[model samples]
Target: MSSNNAIVLKKYIDPTEGYPKIGEHFGLEERPFNLEATKVDEEHPLLLRNIYTSIDPYIRIRMQNPKYKSYLPSLGINQVIPNLTLAEVVKSAVPEHKTGSHVIFMSGWEEYTLVPKQAMGMVQSVNNPYNLPLMTFVGALGMPSQTAYIGLKHIGQPKAGETIYVSAASGAVGQVVGQLAKAMGLYVVGSAGSDEKIAHLKEIGYDAVFNYKKESVHEALPRVCPKGIDIYFENVGGETLDAVLLNANFHARIIFCGCISQYNNPNPYGLKNYSQILTKSIKVEGFIVMNLMPLYQEEYFREMPKLIAEGKLKYKYDVYMGLGSIPEGFLAVLQGNNFGKALSKIADE
Candidate 1:
């Protein structure tokens, strides 16, 4: 009927610079978001708020001013912090789009977003609602799982019986990677920041689990991987990565997924074992999900759902209800307080 309210970010965050950086909210505007009733653009579709939002770790990268040449620069000052959201189309100007169609996108931290056709790759349809949870399109069946699928298969290239280690192993990407590695018959071990997270990793079938905050990575990794690690699914990249580098088997592969440990750093921490890369002859590579689109289109759509249906793949979600809580929930994710896929359920229907 009328315009909907959206959560707007007033300023960029610098997690270590000060407290003001992390939790300051400034509303921008309460404007109309209608499309068909108004003069509709040929490209944009008017979307409804089916599911509000989800908070993800990668979003923290966009919250700061760029230091090095990042693939995508940090978020601009006073902009809506973007995330993957599941939305229903209420009206559309594009003939290809129809009302009542549910889709996923990196468009809104707000209730409803107007997605342009050019950006449709980021927004995919949910046609198998009878088989899968709709929110999973933004979670296990979505970007996170796709990210893990690409990183492990392409970069990590794990072989059965080889040791594979994952950091932040209880979060969205880590959990999926661990499960997939186990299914492939690899020896999987992982480290998390909490005791609870370690238990969760074990429950998910990790061979060994450790709380990196309490145990030394240097000591812990060596003990678990006596034969040295064949592959590492890196997430928390600081001391943990350094430790893996030191003990990695010759020609071991390392997939640089996300550096969650250093995302909030005001000052950077230099890795002490980088020289190990050269000495051990390790192949280390960084990747983004979009780069492996062709492979993912084949794997994610076909394999992930089949695994879920057969019970080979299991997923967990941390849901926060109501649209108004989007901002707070996002902040929690950036701070590493959320486990599993952080979700905001805006509507049950």
Candidate 2:
């Protein structure tokens, strides 16, 4: 068996420094992926070829140094790029995991991996699993869904009759948040980068939608939420966030799920309207979904799927085929080319 195929990061992408570079591939003997296989190290489980992989904005943050606690830790210099993946278990020494089972975990941008078994979650428990697409486990029903779950609970704390605005409204987290807000009886408004995405938001039940690229957020937001936005589900930051700050009602809640606007920058931008957080009595907080994993396992997983099955919730994904296409797929996402959750299919029926 051969194991030379992998996507390795060549070095840190310091824009002040220069453009990002990709490294060359190495064989299994080189073990450039740093797979550790030792028994009694019960947590790590050897994962088979991934069925699906995710390309989210958060992964871009992990490419930076350990300074931002947004992710577990930055991938090591010269290491395989880490990503969220859905994989079948080829072997497992852990009691909870069985060979041939499908699970979700942190793995490499490759065909196979040895993820710590404890990091894996059994997806079969979600009910009627076969009827649902496997890619959903990594998208609407997976990490992005989890991000929405926590963002709403901790940041938005949405109440009935409140008006909420979601930026980047057609992307993975935005779609989930918009639908969930509508189901919660809130008037949901959204902003998207394209007209097509704005239309999709309306089809999914957003009360109002705007194409941010066509209309300035400063102008479009007030027109949509004239009563003022009580909750802001922020995905793209920078100017959009500034506009939201100006339009926020008193006592607003801002859930900072991501700042996609600043991800590619060599020197990240600072929010100029931050002082509004104090003036509007707004609560602004940022989070990475991993910190909320225990909460999801304890409460969200049990509640969210029922809402989904009942049609009160919805999700979307943009899927690509084959492991080899991942880099291009991910770049498209970084460029906002994907409308929803961006993912790739590495396995077939």
The number of the candidate with the highest TM-score is 1
TM-score of 1: 0.90
Could you tell me every candidate's TM-score relative to the true structure? 0.90, 0.86
Across 192-287, the per-residue lDDT of candidate 1 in tens digits comes to 878888888888899998888888999898898888899999888887888899899999999988887777776667898899999989998999
Each model's total of backbone clashes: 1, 2
The collision pairs in model 1 are 62-75
Residue lDDT tens for model 2, 260-307 = 877776676767887888999998888878787776665876777677
Q: What is the C-alpha lDDT of each candidate?
A: 0.76, 0.74
Backbone clashes in model 2, listed as residue pairs: 43-117, 44-116
User: Which regions of candidate 2 fall more than 4 Å away from where they truly are?
Assistant: 2-4, 15-47, 65-71, 115-131
Cα deviation at 167, candidate 1, in Å, is: 0.3
Measured by lDDT, the strongest candidate is 1
On a 0 to 100 scale, what is the lDDT of residue 329 in model 1?
69
Q: Model 1: runs farther than 4 Å from truth?
A: 1-3, 14-43, 50-52, 66-68, 117-122
